[model samples]
Target: MNQNIFENISDLITSGAFLEAEQAAVDLLEEIESKDDGSQAFVIFKFNVAGFLVDIGHALSNRGYALKAVEIFESLEPRIEGVIDPHQYFYNRANAKCHIVEQVSTFDLTFSSIETLVEAKNEYWKSIKEARKVNEEFPEQYVNLANCLKRQFRLSEALWYYDSIREMAPEIPQSWINRSEALLMLNTVSNSYSGKMLHEISSGYNQASRSKFLPPDYAAYYGEQAERFRQGISENDHAETKKEFEELSEYRKYCCRSSLTLSEHGLYCSCAGAARDNLTIPLAATTVGGAFVPQMEAVLNRLKSEFSMARRCYFEYTEAEIEIDLIHEECFTDLETNECLGLDFEKLRTAFRLCFGVLDKIGFAICEHHSLKPKSGMVYFQNFWQLDRDNRREKFEEIKTPGLLALYSIATDLNEHKNGEWKNFKRLRNAMEHGFLVIVHPGSVDDIFGAYELSGDVELVELDVFEKMVEQMIQLTRSAIFSFVFHFRQKGLEESVPTGPTVSFQRVNLQM
Candidate 1:
């Protein structure tokens, strides 16, 4: 087959000749698959077909047929799995999916549309990892990834990516523009109302307007918005303005105090009085038909208890010195030499396990209280927000609670991503549970001896890396707990007044 035929197919798709392009693509695919020629020319033909498929996908996407573009892109995977590099292929599909969210719709609560967007986000991550493997910066992919996070209402996570893009490629206008949008959304949602924060948002728009490719009207619109933000505050007392903003930001407060207690927002308080400052729940002692209060308290308190135990183990590990006895040294030594590679510290191990363990506990509590019923008897943190275990977006349509979106973001943190650290934490947890996990000092291991014996049964992590992972696990668990509590507060704020008679309750404490 002539390569001109592939070009013709692309031309057809580009010209909006959909019916003709479909027949041409179908005929070419059949002709290519039917051929079994033992020649290099045949392999080249397959590559051409794969490229044409990608072109068609892009053409469809450019024309606003994003879902169709997704199907077209997916069809290329099996055709050239081992022959062609898939980084660009993954990127194009991600762009198409993103277009669906931008131009089409997330369908709001519809699971399929939500799945498309989430898959697009994950695909962008995969593309980023693949680009890094080849030493490519792929800054646009980073922006796209951040855009996905922003769409999911994950402004903080999105800001990191946008900020990184600005650092690495300052000329990219989208980075500044999107970063400003994210910051503005954060300030608005949290009601920080700080003049300094608004000024930063204003500055970002002005900076982005410097790009030559930016439309004059678009720049003008943003310029007006920026001026509006700037006019909100006087150009004096900068320190006080920034201070007031930081103090009013609920997001910043939760983040700064995450390590202090899991109940920084007080949703997990054991008593109504303790929760009054942050949340309000009726108490059993003063309200009629308040048995449900104690039951809910038991559930929340159990989660608090689990998190506190993990925090204590972490604290002990940080404070205590390693006492290496002769037997312990022998068990950890790679050879007869005195150098020890493996760390068999029980406190660190306990903290690692407990941190990961509490995620499932928090998941169960969220599902039970938020009325997100699971399809299966088994529930895990990663699967808490979805109806199906394999599909992360299966329950997006079902999430009515405002703060649960944030909690769902926590679940995504635990999910496996290409070149992601969270996956390593999860694998280490699995190794501890079902196999062998060794925390080794990288310096103690000899290069001459090779990295390790060829055994699939054990997982080896450097001591520094393991310690970092333990710390991350603790923080992750804490964030999930905070999100869980905030879910109720957000719900309480959203719900309308009760139509039925309601009881008033007072705080009571028992003397032990």
Candidate 2:
């Protein structure tokens, strides 16, 4: 490897000529690859080359070319396995994705932006796992992960991450600022926990404001936020908040009552309410308005119905009573040699299948609403985000609804991530769709495997694991439904009203 070439690339990066640096780095990487002499010295040079590529990626990210930075990192992924520290590589990738997320406009959902954020979250998780293997603690990774969770609107999980960081590294000013920001966001949505945490939140901001590590502008911002929060303490309306909760509908109350409540699941009842309340009126006939209104309403209605069914089946599977005869006889196998039999719960299976089906249906709805034409006239939830990988930014990306973006994130999770919960669900769904799926006893398998690992033609899943998959799928489906309705509702609100004369249609009430 030529040392001068590496030096030139570094100098270019230092001079903020990132485009030149990127090109030089790519050319050098190609030259190194082409001249692999299979020598020990050459092998060591490759690792050095890997580190240099990482630097190039960082420089591109700094230059606000985060997507380009991501592309560069992705190019390195094939050879990165043993060349670099996997944790460090993933952390760097996560940071690049976070940069993309930050640059994304608050409106106009782009595939790269929201999907990148989800990818960043997954990469951070991989980094966390790698760190855990070596018994290493990195507060910055936790803070970044918390920030990702906050951006995803998972306030409860974000708060937990922030609290964990504070306990381990209280001196970190960013964690305090991030926690305070999450609290402020929570206050706007729900008073359930915000009112109780207001004083502590204000104090956190105050502490952040005093930190010398933060820039002067940042410190002043925190100080103003702290004072503003402190003022809210004097005008707190606990009575009104309590009354609001009291007035919550049965559905909202049920959502709040779950073990994984509204906040924990990232599914807000307020979002669903906003869509349902405002979208009830029938619209006047126009070129597309009339068709859009009915279609949107129908999709919303089906989403609610599907979610209700999935939730009911899930609950019945977990909590409903069953006859002793309904249990398989093999379930009573002796403890020492126990590899019991699968319990045949139709409700659980129904819930799992329904959850999978509903997601695909939502994809179809999105395609219809956006007038998006999928390749081969086929659209699955997994492939709904992009039909052509080459054309990364499709027309669908123009819809910048937050909930819809979240929906796409869920699709990314199910389709891409190898996390057991999501991967298992996808595997099971695939088996049901194109292969045979069989349930085995919970203890039958020493470890879980994908649907492709089949005995003859059937894929076997542990009964308990299948049950858990059903439970999670139900929750995911619920979140997807909320995202579909709420985000589109938000998009509707953001658009300017029509100024020209329009026909008015009477509000039609459907009899149940």
Q: lDDT: which candidate is best? A: 2
lDDT of 2 by residue, 1-512 (tens): 66787778767765557678877766776777787775645544554555455556554544344555566567666766666577777787787777765533334435555656777888887887687677775998899888876676545556667766888888788899888877665544322343335665787899888886665666788899888777656444445444555676655554444422323212222222221222221221212233354556677677667766766666665665665766645345343322333443666777788888888888888777776647667877866566355463556566755566667666766775324216556777777667867666656444333433445555677777677667557656665665565555554444456333332445322110
Q: Candidate 1 local accuracy as lDDT?
A: 0.58
Candidate 1 lDDT, tens digit per residue, 354-454?
87777887777666755565667577787555545544454544554424565565566667642232666777788889887766655555535544454
Q: How accurate locally, in lDDT, is each candidate?
A: 0.58, 0.61
Q: Measured by TM-score, how close is model 1 to the native structure?
A: 0.61
- Which run of 10 residues does model 1 get worst, by summed lDDT? 264-273
Question: What TM-score would each prediction reach against the true structure?
Answer: 0.61, 0.59
Off by over 4 Å in 2: 1-89, 100-105, 112-118, 128-143, 149-220, 230-254, 257-291, 312-350, 387-394, 416-424, 438-455, 461-475, 494-512
On the 0 to 100 scale, the lDDT of residue 367 in model 2 is: 76
Q: How many clashes does the backbone of model 1 have?
A: 0
